[model samples]
Target: MKVLITGKGGQLATELIKVFPNKFDVVALSSHELDIVDAESVERSIAAVKPAIVINAAAYTAVDKAEDNQQRAFDVNYLGCENLAHACKAAGCSLIHVSTDFVFDGKKATPYFVDDVPNPINVYGASKLRGERGITNVLEDAVVIRTAWVYSGTGNNFVKTMLSLMQNKPELSVICDQIGTPTWANGLAQFILHIASKYGEGERQSLVPKPVTYHWTDAGVASWYDFAVAIRDLGIEKGILKQAIPINPIPASQYPLPAERPSFSVLDKTETEGSTGFKTTHWRHQLDKMLDEYTEDSKLSEGKT
Candidate 1:
């Protein structure tokens, strides 16, 4: 099956491109290749690719910035998804729209389930929720995967930021109140491909269901402070960092941002695991895997030089 992936340069898109070609005819497009917000552009791209599966990974991800850039956020997150859904429908292709855990306000103590009522607390979350609605409204069969706290070897994310900050600063402050699972982009990419494969097999058998939403994250949970401390310790153990960096846990109020975040947004993946018949790696293990990979790649590069 031919697969069309948007947001080529993103962390998840990059991982998808790396793995997709092994199983499918992949057509990956960056923002330069396709402007998802423009209906004409989306239509033309889908028509040209004629993919059996269209994965819309592009999104406006600036959580804090979205507060001041509501229009742009809505344009890209909401309208862009609507356009992609319509294009996929016209092209008779299934869609895999990536969403976020931010859709929920995070007041619940337990992990969020797929059917939980979403009451987004910030503009970014609201826009993403709107995007989810737009896609489902247009294409009921689209698979919408809501993930959280994503990080990868190559990306602007918590892991990368913490590593950099630890190297330069003696002490770093992280919010202890905010909690969620840290999903590895590569792992999430693999899950998406697995779903696509299941969908393909379902074309011939009753293996996969049509147009469902799922929450995926690395198993287990951690606050920002926990994540940073782990990153620091793991970086040192893996030789990614030269020295230990002290991490100070502070409340969210200590460090103010333009946008408010859910205090707890961990997603329950039991249903997703049951559906796929495979369990996801724990977030700590995922972190170790990425850190190990990063270390090996860096050593290999240094050796070549």
Candidate 2:
């Protein structure tokens, strides 16, 4: 099987590569190698590789920054996805598009389901919803997987931010009102592969089958404050840190930012778990695993054999 992935250097894309190392003939591209915003460049890359499957991992992920720079975010997140979808259609390849929970307005008391309608309040969510629409509209065999609060072994994410904040501040202030699940990049990446690979089997058949979208993340939900507390607790459990100042919970208003965030952004996993046949780890378990890896990495970097 030949699979091509975008955003070569991102945390989620990097995890997909790590988990599926040498399993398939893989062609990974950074934005520099193939800019998604440029139509001709995207077409050329897709034609050159001729992959059986294409995973759209490249995205405009700077949420707060996007409030100030809407055009660039739309250019990359919306227009870029349109390019990928069109390329997939022209190449006769099945496409898997990564999306975010931000697509919803966070009005529901329950978790967002695959069937739920999206009502985005922010530019970042609006752009991503456009990306989802682009992929689903262009490709009959495409899969759109929406995830939340993704962190990985590579790249900047919430876990690393908490660790850094604890070291510098006497007390860390986090938003306790906004609730969502924190997903390990590996969990979501693997889930995408299982869905993409299976769905591709009948993609080019004589009769087109129904296209599907799925939602996935770690099992449990927590607010940003809860996540930070768990991160610090895990670090202590793993013996990586002797001590750190406790993290404090504050309402969303206490820490104001450019972008507006959803108060509740959890996603339902009924369809995703059913299709993938892989159970997602609880957020707490994932947190421990990440902390352990961080501890090992720190030791290695310090030249500790």
Clashes of each: 1, 0
Q: What are the per-residue Cα lDDT tens digits for candidate 2 across 1-305?
A: 78889999999889888776465788999999989999999999999999988888899999999999999999999899999989888888878889999999999879999889999989999999998998788888777889999997688999988887776778888899999999999888878776655644653443226557788899998999899989888877777656867777899999988889989999999776875677888999988887787788888989964
lDDT of 1 by residue, 1-305 (tens): 89999998998998899777566999999999999999999999999999999898899999999999999999999999999999999888999999999999999999999999999999999999999999999986888999999988776998889888999997999999999999999999989988888877864135434568889999998999999999999999988899997788999999999999999999999998987775899999999999998888878999999
How do all models score by TM-score? 0.96, 0.95
Report lDDT (CA) for all predictions. Answer: 0.91, 0.86
Q: What lDDT does model 1 reach?
A: 0.91
Clashing pairs for predicted structure model 1, backbone only: 141-211
Best by lDDT: 1
Q: Which ten residues in a row have the lowest lDDT in candidate 2?
A: 199-208
